[model samples]
Target: MEFSQKIDVNILRRTTFSPRVKNARIHVICGPMFSGKTTSLIKAVKSHQKDGKKVFVFKPKLDNRYADEAVVSHDKNEVQAYAVEKSVEILDYYLNADVVAVDEVQFFDDRIIDVIEKIANDGKSVVVSGLDMDYLGRPFGSIPQLLTIADEVTKLNSVCTFCSGRARFSHRISEDNGIVVLGEKDKYVPLCRSCYNELKDK
Candidate 1:
């Protein structure tokens, strides 16, 4: 009778591990111009408010198209927001807020990303809305990175002016050299890929 070799079971023992669960999260609503990103953001804020959550809204000072201190959608839906010239200024009014909403995120500097991330990590929910791409179809400021780290992303679409197809790009009708030309229907139109490419080629 040969004795079988005994396996060392103790060596297989592993350390106890548990992943950290986060209640707070980041939500992003992004798309081209006229995609109703602000509308979605407002809806979210109202929903949270109905639940008795303390919500705070912030918008860049540069966006005074509708109101000096309010976030306004194309359809005239408006929500009061603190107008801040710098991203860090948002922290001044974030006290005891359960939910934070940011409109026109693309207008803010890159520092906005860090500020938003910090708010989320501190157990406060964050909702952000902005254009994902500029007129040239390039990723706008800080939005691409925000999309990557966001827990949820909603990409809205608009009707193409040239065609009835879903528009995913913002085409600048005006011949402006600068990237940031602040205007509404007078300057920009929504276009699908085919229509945008056609117009771009012309």
Candidate 2:
């Protein structure tokens, strides 16, 4: 018998492999403090959930300002999320998810960029929120990379506390010189370029 004739058609059909559809996309929300980045991320998650899509939300373990296992906005808007210390740990809870939302993304290590890319490439949509710049007015961790690779980028702006204009910089008000100090209105203030220059050195 010929090899083709001896082969089972059902087996061949079952063994065939096709690549996953390229429906994945990365969405990034970045801005200075109090610019509603987390709120935007939470909105995306809720929209996906309302459509009956399976969604996974994650926040850095270091971010516990509002809750230990939730993404909370400054206005008290909140959504439950997984608190992971490492970016790779997100994969452990992302199985079969249709949408993944990450808050306080700047707090995670550089590996977060790769993890988020992998998730999007696997045909799952990813939404990330973080500060684009540190208190020193420099690019924050992994946020620049995430912005570069994102399919959609939204840069929001808060009302500048000093001038009432659009805030573009996160100004530090406390005496601490550390780059990773986590605080709300007590330690950080959003300022426009002119206001920032005036207050940054003082």
Candidate 3:
């Protein structure tokens, strides 16, 4: 005769609220490709850590440009991140965390707006970084809307590949007309408005 395994079904529900987490505020960091958006976001997270705040970093599951468990910068700095397929999932992870950061905000759907807003109102810091425009020079989905709700907005600049000027646009050279595309250094180049217009004119 074989014995069946018995499982414990009694567990206590969590109901305590954390006092360390304060009022939530949304921070948006946006720019074109190579504009150091991710770097700036990581810096903010590190600064929060230095202040003795409990911090959590997250990225969209669609962004596989870097490792799934960490957000890596061009300068090789690394920060552990939780990868979720949907922005709504972030709320579940914030239960006990003091600060919540979301990278690649552009990839998330419209629902992210309400989620980010609600989280911020609950007394936690929400930091988001993403490309403001797609390869077609159009606003990349929820990024523009998120900017409106953010408490602070920081726009970064990258070096234009053609003229070494301040790059403000991400020029898409690939055939993909869709807003979302995964690419490397060979796929897109940074350009200033003038240079970008010139390139499009050709």
- For lDDT, the strongest prediction is 2
Q: How are the candidates ranked when ordered by lDDT, highest leading? A: 2, 1, 3
Better of 2 and 3 by lDDT: 2
Better of 2 and 3 by TM-score: 2
List residue ranges in candidate 1 displaced over 4 A.
1-22
lDDT of 1 by residue, 1-202 (tens): 9986986676656544442435788999999889899999999999999999999999988888989988889899988899999999998889679999999899899999999998997789999999998999999999999999899999999999988899999999898968888889999999999999999756
Least well predicted 10-residue stretch by lDDT in candidate 3: 7-16
The whole-model lDDT of each prediction reads: 0.91, 0.91, 0.86
Candidate 2, residues 1-202, lDDT tens digits: the string is: 6466576778988896665856578999999999999889888999989999899999999888878988889889998899999999998989779999999899999999999988987889999999999998999999989999999999999999978999989999899998989998999899999999998888
Ranking by TM-score: 2, 1, 3
Query: Clash number for every model?
Result: 0, 0, 5
